[model samples]
Target: MKSSPIGGDEHPRPLIREVVVINKQGIHARPAALFVKTATKFRADIGIEKEGEVVNGKSIIGLLMLAAGEGTKLTLTAQGQDAEKALAELSKLFEDKFSED
Candidate 1:
């Protein structure tokens, strides 16, 4: 995992956040595409874990396999440069229901 300091201090600790998918459509197709796009914007290495299965955040296919439906909670982990920012952005994305109604 690529880990960076939360504030550019050089620490190598990874950050984690719990997010729930609340969108009616869950993370399918376009929403998954949007998620992958947002995740790739950061330099940190990000991954999503559901139940016991973990998948790379940068992989659209991996994300789709998650088959996360509404109310499915997921653990988001990030390490490397901008880990905090990555989690924050991702958390916000999830809170926004991936911009879906």
Candidate 2:
């Protein structure tokens, strides 16, 4: 998984409002995969920040390293032509607790 792979473009980026991982287990393999799956749906560069490290939001490995334990706050950023839509979708996924059951 790459970190901040997409860059050098002069496009505006949409910053994701703080999203807290309320899920008890935080981001595990299953949820990480799910999160990346959602991020791939749009054509935008997405990034997730944790502890000052920014990882590619669409990469499973990157997301897992975030170690977003329960209540951990994450900042998602999407920049590209469709940044708004991508950011919205990504945020929605987090809001849904990665669809954990």
Q: How close is candidate 2 to the true structure, as a TM-score?
A: 0.82
Q: Please give, for residues 1-101, the per-residue lDDT of candidate 2 as tens digits.
A: 33344564456646565678878889988888988998898777889998689999889989888888888888888877667788777778778887775
Which stretches of candidate 1 lie above 4 Å from their native place? 1-11
Consecutive 10-residue window with the lowest summed lDDT within model 2: 1-10
Q: Clashing residue pairs, candidate 1?
A: 2-79, 2-80, 3-79, 3-80, 4-80
Please give the CA lDDT of all the candidate structures.
0.89, 0.80
Model 2 global lDDT (CA atoms, 0 to 1): 0.80
Looking at model 2, residue 52 earns an lDDT score of: 85
Clash counts for all predictions: 5, 0
Best by TM-score: 1
**What digit string (tens of lDDT, one per residue) describes model 1 on residues 1-101?**
53333455554777989999999999899989988998999888999999989999999999999999999999999987788889999889889988889
lDDT of 1: 0.89
Residue 33 displacement (Å), model 2: 0.4
lDDT of 1 at 79: 88
